[model samples]
Target: MTAAALLLWRDFVRDPARRLWTEDSGCGEWGCCGSPLEARAFLEGVLRGMSRRRSRELRAVVDALDDAY
Candidate 1:
C-alpha cells in the first residue's frame, strides 16, 4: 500500500508476464519502480490465480500511498 507498490501493480496489469518469475529471464523491464528482482517475485505470486478484488484493493492502497508520497 505504497507508491512503489502501486506503481508495481500498475505495471503488472499492463503486462502480465513482464516479470515472469524470480529468475533472471535475461530481460528485465517489469520493475516499474525500478527493481526487476522484486517485481519478478511479485509477479510470480500475482500471476497465479490472481483475483480482481485483490487487484482493486492493491490498486486502491497504491493510489492512497501514491497520494501520500
Candidate 2:
C-alpha cells in the first residue's frame, strides 16, 4: 500500500488531472487532493491512521520525504 501510494502520488504530481485513491475515508473515496501538499497530507493521514506495527517503516519513509520536502 505504501509503494502503491507513492507511485500514485508520483503520477498525480506529474498530472494533477489524475485521481488518487485511498482506503482512508477522510481522504475521500477517490481522494480530493488538489495539490502536492494536500496529497502528501492525505498520504500522511492514512499512514498515521495505520497500526504502529504496520506503519513503522512507512512512517520512516514519510518522515524522510517530509525532511526532503
TM-scores of the models, in the given order?
A: 0.28, 0.51
Write down the lDDT of every candidate, Cα atoms only: 0.50, 0.60
Model 2, residue 5: distance off in Å is 4.7
Candidate 2 residues lying further than 4 Å off, grouped into runs, are: 1-5, 8-34
| Candidate 1 ranges with C-alpha deviation above 4 Å | 23-69
Positional deviation of 14 in candidate 1, in angstroms?
1.6
Give the Å shift of residue 36 in candidate 2: 0.8
Please give, for residues 1-69, the per-residue lDDT of candidate 1 as tens digits: 234544664554456575464455445554323454464445445534457766676556545533443
Model 2 earns a TM-score of 0.51
